[model samples]
Target: MTQQLDFSVGMGKETTYGSPSAVTRFFESEAKAKYDVKTIKGSGLRPTKGVARTSRQSISGFEGSTDIELDAPTRGLGFLLNAVMGAVTNTLVSTGLYQQVHTLSTTDPVASYAIQEALPPIGGGASNVHTFRGCVFDSLEISAKEGAYLSVKLSATILKMLTTGATAASYPSDDTLFSFVHGSIQVGGSLTEPGATTLAVGDAIPAVNISDFSLKVARNLDKKGWNLGGAGLRSRPPVLGKPEITGKITAEYTDNVLRDAYLAQTPLVLILTFTSGSNVLQIAMPAIKLKGEVPTSNGGDVITQSIDFEAFDNGTASQPIFIVYRTADTTP
Candidate 1:
């Protein structure tokens, strides 16, 4: 029966496609079998042009239809089995798991890898392909000046998708998975001196989104309707989508978004702001708990606070965001 494969996960529903275990089992069975076939002949007189015989008894002794003794190699059971095994081996490696999946990696807006670049058309981040797990529909990034209040604005529809499916709906409707962590001090790019800065207290914050960009997934050549038993493959139905975070970063943040981030350790930074000061209060990026809050300065009255964030990696150059542990500044 033709299997109706709908991908809730990794397999091509029904039974046409063999699983990884099937190929593994096939290999195991191939190695253990003992019965084999072979063919050879002994000949003295030639009955037919292609007959297994020689003019003299030196090469082939003599010949008779069944009477001519079969050679050790071609006429034996080993030869027959060997021929059959050859075909089986071809099927094994050709349509095996190793041929399908290769390397796997995670990607985001900061860093990304292509899956379709490996294999086109058949190899897309769609229902048929695997490796697309926990991916969301879209993502965006927004940046703004700092202010007195803590906020992250979302100009882009973070949760919204290209296709308006309910489960994949965008903002002004549901909650978001990605959130902010610790808010901190950012070096103002525009500031010529230390005091000339902006605060993020009253602005919006948008999250760094990582979407359906695959790091790496191999080509499943033998991935048939009931293809390799990958919990990732789907028959006719759709495969699970990769988790995605797409939206512009803004200075506006909802109460829930800010509060939950303050509670959980997931997103790392949730709120950040800057104010006029003589010394550096804190650094923005990694989360850190400190005693006492930094009071806002006004010169008793001008622009009170100002700051903005730029993700940086101390040692590793390419990484946009880095998680690092801090200790006493003994050496410096």
Candidate 2:
């Protein structure tokens, strides 16, 4: 007999941040469900150590945290990105027309969601399904190559964990590939773009050879734990700390334009888009400034510049980091 393999994974958009769901509705709409899942790795129950006078080893306390790794996706990745950045979408209904826009504004508080995965049994028992509750997006890194599909690596923090017999069995629909061929990188002095919302598909930096680019967002999360003479498991919500956003870009150095931008502290806008006929998906970061080390040299086959930048508030909601997804279906 062959062994059972673990493959199915599902997630839900939480109505309330850090609130666990009933597990009854584990999947989202088939059309909007995130399907380009590359990998799911998690940390089981970890214990904090305490020293005592009698024992040689330290004492074990309540479970610390369950950190999970969700590999990045090209298609349908914005849904998960919204959860971590506390980004939200707004639907404007006009005369027989509905427009959906996703935004990650400075004033917006980050949101949370629930994630679960099915694993194979270890010793010929029933399949085990684990659910992570109160899960918050901690950090994310997106890597994009010239011709390859954009890869995303995501990290999330959870408050609690639950295991049960595997029953939910289904996968979401396939996704259209998103790659650097359908992306754009622009550097300017200000966050203001003349026609940002209506940017055409061919609007990108000209004569610049871009090899790769990356973006990282971090929400400094802290957990509270105090001794109160307790017997049962004590759980508290993970507190959000000062958040951070940073990114890097590797490109062929053609001119002194990037160096000039760094010296004058200029802003940059990154727009990655995927389109097939009338369907479109995009991730836009309208306000970002270079704060890291300036590119000197990559010492590679070609003269390349590897520069890092930090995301900043542009003092306007329209200029903030956002994701715009257009499909026939409304829900995501």
Candidate 3:
């Protein structure tokens, strides 16, 4: 799933000079879900539902894991003007690059000096090879608009609601074609300005004036045998009214470099929510740490990171029955 993150970064250069101002975007609202859902909208009367039963069984805990891969897309590089052979570094470099060249800024260059410099410059423009699976995210790129930096904060949230179709007796496979909604941005463009702007359906930011957005991860969670009552202080509050089976995972940073680092190996939180009668409740996955981290072979260029997880339980059950993601509004 995708969420809004304010991505802005400057190494010794931008820091010494001045970093771009980061705009804060909160999760506004998502487009009407294609499913048959009942959400609260407008001011007037909010939707009121049933209360949670303290005596019922619930999931107590769980963890998040990850898997990742990377490739230099054709749009980003490969060939150059026939006369000039592009320089290439097989691995990543610690010092970030700008305009396809070594970024000269550094803290103590002598200490973390780049292992290798520039990799062969890849041509820019359309047909850039794209990589995505599970939940697809957007890439960062320079924008034509003014006052905009080139990066996304890179926050991601996923929700897994126990759908009616997925019962205690069912198990899903990689081939299952369930409906999914994802929201995200990579290393390009800043958050949109705040104002009374018109919003599109599924757009995280509302009429503007907020930083960050969220998407539905999974709906219809299930934990047939878990004892959710043990969650004492770790419990998430119930929402009175809203849309979708809301859940989320979020991490924030104005520094694109750091954000990239996190992308390589940062723990992301995922929340799962459910509606029973009139009450809406959520389940939490205690840990979202990545499975591992890998440095580029030569240069310090940050590439891919991954994580792993086994669906958790409230201790009442033995197997993981629920999933989680992000909500449209992240303010609370």
Clashes of each: 97, 1, 66
- What would the TM-score be for candidate 1 when compared with the true structure? 0.17
lDDT tens string, model 1, 103-187?
1123212111111001113334433221211111122222232322222211100110111111211111211111122224221
Worst 10 residues of 1 by lDDT: 22-31
> What's the TM-score of each model vs. the native?
0.17, 0.71, 0.16
- Choose the strongest candidate by TM-score: 2
Q: Model 2, 1-332: lDDT tens per residue?
A: 11355434566656675465543223222111122112223333335633332333333333323333333332345566665666555453333222345554344344656676665566555555676665666676667777776666666655455665344655335445556666655554333332323432324454356677877777666655424652222344455676777888776778777777788887766665555444455556766777544556555666777888887777673545655655443344
Show where candidate 2 strays beyond 4 Å.
Answer: 1-4, 13-76, 90-100, 105-110, 122-126, 165-167, 189-207, 225-234, 292-300, 316-319
> For residues 1-332, what per-residue lDDT tens digits would candidate 3 score against the true structure?
11222111111111111112211211111211111122223333324724434344344343221111111111222111000111211222123211121111112211100000011123432221111111111111111111221111111111111111111111112111111111222221222211112111122221111123222222212212223552322122111111122222222222343245345654333332222222122223322333323323335443322212222223442212221111111111
Error of 1 at 70 (Å): 85
lDDT of each: 0.20, 0.54, 0.20
Model 2 CA lDDT for position 318: 55
